[model samples]
Target: MFSTGQMIFAGLFVIAFATAIFITYQKDKKLHAKNYKGAVWVAVAFFVFIAILFAIKYTLKN
Candidate 1:
């Protein structure tokens, strides 16, 4: 039941979420090489951002 604009927005949101995950993974790889702890926090923050994006999208639809 979504309009074209809504669908496009949702797709873009998903892309953004995926990009965040990719960036986090790359950072994790570098951090792992350096033996840093920030990678865990980066992953946590990425998921939180994705969750927030989903919440906003659903809220808009409802």
Candidate 2:
């Protein structure tokens, strides 16, 4: 187990990292909107394909 110092340092590091990422994403929001417009549909298709595979596997197991 880590001492109090390590834990505190890790917590602070996570907070700072997350904040930086959020700020970067905010700055890139406009560019993302322009370039990655069809991302949602791609994600949906990927999830649907995985679900179908699982359904087939489950059906075969019975």
Candidate 3:
């Protein structure tokens, strides 16, 4: 069982960590948009490829 102080510290740590991450992402948000324009299509293609593989596997298994 954690002490009250430890619990409080954990809560504060989580809040600080999330805030830091949010700020960092916000700073880079514009750069990310400019540099990764085609990233979404790449991700969609990757998922489609995986789905095709799974379909082939299921077909062979049956």
For 1-36, candidate 3 gives per-residue lDDT tens digits of 999999999999999999999999999999999999
Residue pairs of candidate 3 with colliding backbone atoms: none
What is the per-residue lDDT of model 2 for residues 28-49, given as tens digits with 9 covering 90 to 100? 9999999999999999999999
TM-score of each model, in listed order: 0.46, 0.92, 0.86
Candidate 2 local accuracy as lDDT? 1.00
Local error of candidate 2 at residue 33 (angstroms)? 0.7
Model 1 alpha-carbon drift over 4 Å, by segment = 30-62
Please say which candidate is ahead in TM-score: 2 or 3: 2
Candidate 3 has a TM-score of 0.86
Worst 10 residues of 3 by lDDT: 12-21
In candidate 3, residue 17 scores what lDDT? 100
Whole-model lDDT, candidate 3?
1.00
Question: What C-alpha lDDT do the candidate models reach, one value each?
Answer: 0.92, 1.00, 1.00
lDDT for each residue of candidate 1 in 1-61, tens digit (9 for 90 to 100): 8999999999999999999999999978866768876778899999999999999999999
Better candidate by TM-score, 1 or 3:
3
Error of 3 at 8 (Å): 1.7
- Tell me the lDDT of model 2 at 46: 100
